[model samples]
Target: MAKAIQKITLDRSEDIPFDKLELSQKNVRNIKAGVSIEDLANDIALRGLLMSLNVRPVLGDNDEETGRYEVPAGGRRYRALELLIKQKRMAKTEPIPCIVKRGASTSVEDDSLAENVHRLQLHPLDQFRAFQTLHLQGLGEEEMAARYFVSVSTVRQRLRLASVSPRLLDLYANDEMKLEQVMAFSITNDHVRQEQVWDTVSRSHVREPYYIRRLLTEAAVRAADRRAVYVGVEAYEAAGGVVMRDLFEQDQGGWLQDPALLEQLVFEKLKTDAEALKAEEGWKWVDAAIDFPYGHASGLRRFYGERTELSADELARYDEVKAQYDKLDADYAKAEDYSEETETRLEELGNELDRLNDRPHVFDLEEVARGGVFVSLDASGELKIERGFVRPEDEPAGEVDDADDGDNDGNVGVATSVTGGISVNGKPVAVETQEEEDDKIRPLSDRVIEDLTAARTIALRNALASDPIMAFVAALHAFVLKTFFLYGSDSCLEVTMQSAKFGQTQGLGDTVGAKEIEQRHEAWGHDLPKTPAELWDYLVALDEASRQALFAHCVSLSLNAVVQPWNRRPAAIAHAEQLARSIGFDMVDAGWTPTVDNYLGRVTKAHILQAVREAKGEQSAQLIDHLKKPDMAREAARLLEGSGWLPEPLRLAVDETPAVQSNDDAAELVGDNVVEGADADLPAFLAEDADSEDAASEGAEVEEHRHLDPAE
Candidate 1:
């Protein structure tokens, strides 16, 4: 036809006995890849020759037929067949379907290369759908994994991915969605919710798997939460509460789907447990709550019962342990360096001694009967039973012991107890003494003592002021005694140090700053003098360096930068600002930053917007202002994080010109410009919105002026 097209004939295909086939050395695949031989063999056994092997007839040097074939392409399949035959699962002479390539024009290497390289892999979505079908058709995950030569987890993950909304699955199939994103959607069974979350995340800038999970579980309670831990997952499930889990990641416990049901179970279980404790401990009343806020026991009187007396056996064991500990400790001290065996023995002995010393207190039967207990869950989810709490109204009336039983007072007769009288200042003193009013020596009344102490303190202050060195030393002494001593001190110079105790601020105890403050306090307390009277002498003996260190610590304790909502002391706050400027106290250096739980999330929308606008930009603030309060707060926190922006109250007071960038300088200036009881500093947008509202509402807003310092 045009030069007469050559008649084309395809390779002949036929079934050849497995025993007649031989391996070809010309095969291009020298290195192992893709599925293993064992898995391929299993797959072949289960599905049986899905693809035909390519074979060429063997030829001798003379170019004559040898009645045998060599496989070039499909080498893995040929190996799998050989394995099946070796295992006796298939007959050696069994017919194997194959395509025979003939003629010298076509090379075995070319065929092998084409066979290996031209193949296309099955799409992941197709695999997922097929696995899902198999699962729906009553195939177990393990069986499917074995049949497909994959891990059981892989099979489960594929199935989970397929179970999401068909729309999302379609998107995944169409290559518009990531596998991880699809896996995130597989966490929930609600198809509608999966689609909704997808819609939201698809349009959002942050479409990571974690963000998807967060949005889905925004309303759900974490399994690690106090309430969830209190009611365990098994119990929650038993109570018909569903838990959503991520099979693709380590979801630290997972999310409880039904918060209502979880809370219900938690409260019910807590109530039942509380009742059991009440019955066991014989408490007059039992108060149970999910959370008992810090200082909940402020007004409640806490009394300790006498420690239970040790039995003879226990006392003997304690003595033995104590003796061993003492010997080991002394030996270790004598050694220049620690010996492993000796140190270990000392530690063991010390632990044993401590165990012996930790004997439980034995409360009086009457007290136990009248007192109550607080039943709650600790951070570790264990039952925290605070016992022996006697309410003020429930206290028993005082009973007077018989006065005439002894000498009207509970005292031993001096004449019977003493052999000789004591002398003071060369004057002999009577064994029996009584307080008597006299001109030279009279017992000072309480009021007189107070007045005298007040006068002495004034004189001391004046004298100390005149002598700076002495004043510093005295201040340092008072600080050291207060910090290191556990017992009440009678130090003439009283330096009132305030612990960073939170009252109006919620969640303050859980802050990092609070923990550091507490640790510092404890460390100082361990080194301070225990007795108040000895405190003055100890300070006097301390070196100048130690005195300076103590002075700094005491002055730091009196620093108050807290901006409470109800109590807004302008003069005090202004002075605190001035102090900050003087000391160069940088809040950023203290590691304080904007966070959802710390600052941004607890403030108003206006404040959050202001923070973002200041820290990030006006555009960043606008991006989050349209969201709901909680969402906006969370986003604002993200934008403002690490920006080193501080509220007006937390900023340093500016003096003259700043030597650095003026981010904090602006805050200081704004703070200085603020007028008391006026909305003079309100943002233009806020002011505009306020004008549209009623006058009464505006007045209310003015009265409830927000603190410039966001002390969350």
Candidate 2:
């Protein structure tokens, strides 16, 4: 009882002449899509016909073959062949490969729809690997680009993606990572590091491409950094240095792998340039550095020279250019829109005017011989040469004062050193006598004023710090003055805080806090208006929340908790303490604790013991008192790990408005946690005193006491 299966006949295929093949009207493709007909023709010309056309025989009314074929599925290929024939690349009489379908059950429309819908495109990863293979097969990037009709940059990107770590490629192939994330990994070739970064970012909430790049380039120097810019990438590469580039995104200038080498090149070039400048300018000295601090020239006396006189021809040219510039500017300002030609001409005229005005200064030969230039890089990475600076040590001594010579008539003779300024009416004013000048107080020197003001500012800061309400009000006052007042006030204590510069510290720029601050500053600066006149309105238009946040950031920048050996600033230190107390600010919360590297190793044994005694009790302090300084410090650090202890300078004074506590809570928050019980097993160091009555009583009370640890 088995059912019989019916057999089906297949359609026949045959070759037909190119001239005999006609386009099918039943084809479903009406509009143009992927791969233009022109491109298809070129492809067919390069690598003959890869696909045979699906054709059905056209029959006459007699039901016989018409010796002609009609293409349905391969319409594009037919058109390409026809195009090639028209271009004389192929003959109309040439035989064309065709699959002839002589059945009526399956329509040409069905065949055409199936052919277009059933085809699959290659995966991106596969395409990347294919490009890599082609590159390995001796096909140049430009050639591949030409063959595929893609840009050279696109080809490069695919190659870069293919060059990523094998693990990353596997991840991409397995659909474990996104294509953009994989592109980020292509920035570096180190498989281990790539895997490490991937593992890290895979768990982070933000797995953006930029964050990945940031993490990878954390230790690397930016190509736009002053050192890297000074030493061109070409030179760095020529000297065997490597650079990590991002092909998918704009990386500005990419990342330099070898910062040390770049720095070395920068210094060497700077030194050579400095020497050249010194020799050419006949300077006393040429101090060269990659950068000079904010106040590098604070103590130096600067003298500017007169600009050299211009020749008659130069003067005429300058006047002509200035006139042209003024006319063009006025015209442009009056117009609703600027004309390209006028703008270009204005720029040219401006440049010419600058060229005529930017004449070299003519310094006195004697002053030039005594002064020197400070050569460094500016913020924009350009050579900044500050000339005509005379150090105090290099200044010529003043003439010694002598007793005023008197004539026999008993009248005092004026010294030649006497000098006076001319009156507004042109007559020389009488010089004041020494006695009269002594009676009238003279203005203090700049250095002295700075020192004294620095002291007063510190005292005021201390007073402000002790009162948080006052600090807040002062910040608001400062903001209001800056926003509403057009001119500066007479008050000497204006809280104009700027970022602190670590003049002596090396690698200060590499610190985490410094980088964060710089990035935030740049972000804010980019959003701010360029014109100072527009700034007040812009700030006023901002929301209240944004204004407060900006105010807080600006105020926080003014907080000076720094301690230096040479620059004591005792009042500032005191202010820092008061501020800490006012805000309940704990250094431990700010990622600092007693450690051998930062604190313990640097302090004495006695100091360590005292700290332990204050943190832990007397018994705990005695336990490590006998050890050497190093051992004591290490032991003290372990015992005081979470004890909320601070050094003297960092300690806050007692808060006047201290939190009120209950009797039980006061006892609990007094010191180290102490249990109300007899002494448990004591350490060997304290065993000798374990039998003492005082120790027993103290142990019972110490056991019940507890205090909050800032480290917690």
Model 2 regions lying over 4 Å from their true place: 1-12, 316-347, 398-712
In terms of lDDT, model 2 sits at 0.64
Model 2: per-residue Cα lDDT at residue 151? 91
TM-scores for all predictions: 0.68, 0.58
lDDT of 1 by residue, 1-712 (tens): 4697799888878999999999899999999998899889988887889988898899988888798999999889999988998999899999999998878586889888988789899898888889888888999999988887789999988888878898998888888999889888888899999889888877766688877887888889888888888889999999888899899998878999999998788777866787777777677766666645333443344555566778899999998888888887887788898598987887788888888877776666787777776676666677777676665546665522333233212111211111121111111222322223222322222222222222222222222333445445545655664576433222333356532223223343344444444345444554566546878998899888777656655545444434333443343344334434434446665555667755555456777777788888898877876666777777776677788897543445445444676777556643323333123322122222333236786576565544432321
- Candidate 2 differs from the real structure by a C-alpha RMSD in angstroms, to one decimal, of 19.6
Q: Output the TM-score of candidate 1.
A: 0.68
Off by over 4 Å in 1: 1-9, 85-91, 322-351, 396-505, 509-566, 574-593, 604-606, 609-629, 636-646, 650-712
What is candidate 2's lDDT per residue for 1-712, written digit by digit as tens?
9999999876666668899989999999999988889988998998899988888888999989998878898999999999999999999999988878885687789999999899898999999999999999999999998788789999999999998888888988998889989988889877788889888777655477876786788779988887787778899999988899998888887999888888888877877787788778877766676755323443455666667889998888788878878887987899997599987888888888888877887667787787777677755578878787665556687521222112112111111011121001111223322211121222222222232223222333333434445457546645664565433221212366643333333333333344444455444654566457988999999997666656555565465544443333333344444455555554444433566644566545655777898889999988776665655676688788888886644444444434787888667733333212111222121112223236666585344222211111
Q: Ten consecutive residues with minimal summed lDDT in candidate 2?
A: 415-424
Model 1, global lDDT: 0.64
Write out the backbone clash pairs for model 1.
484-528, 489-532
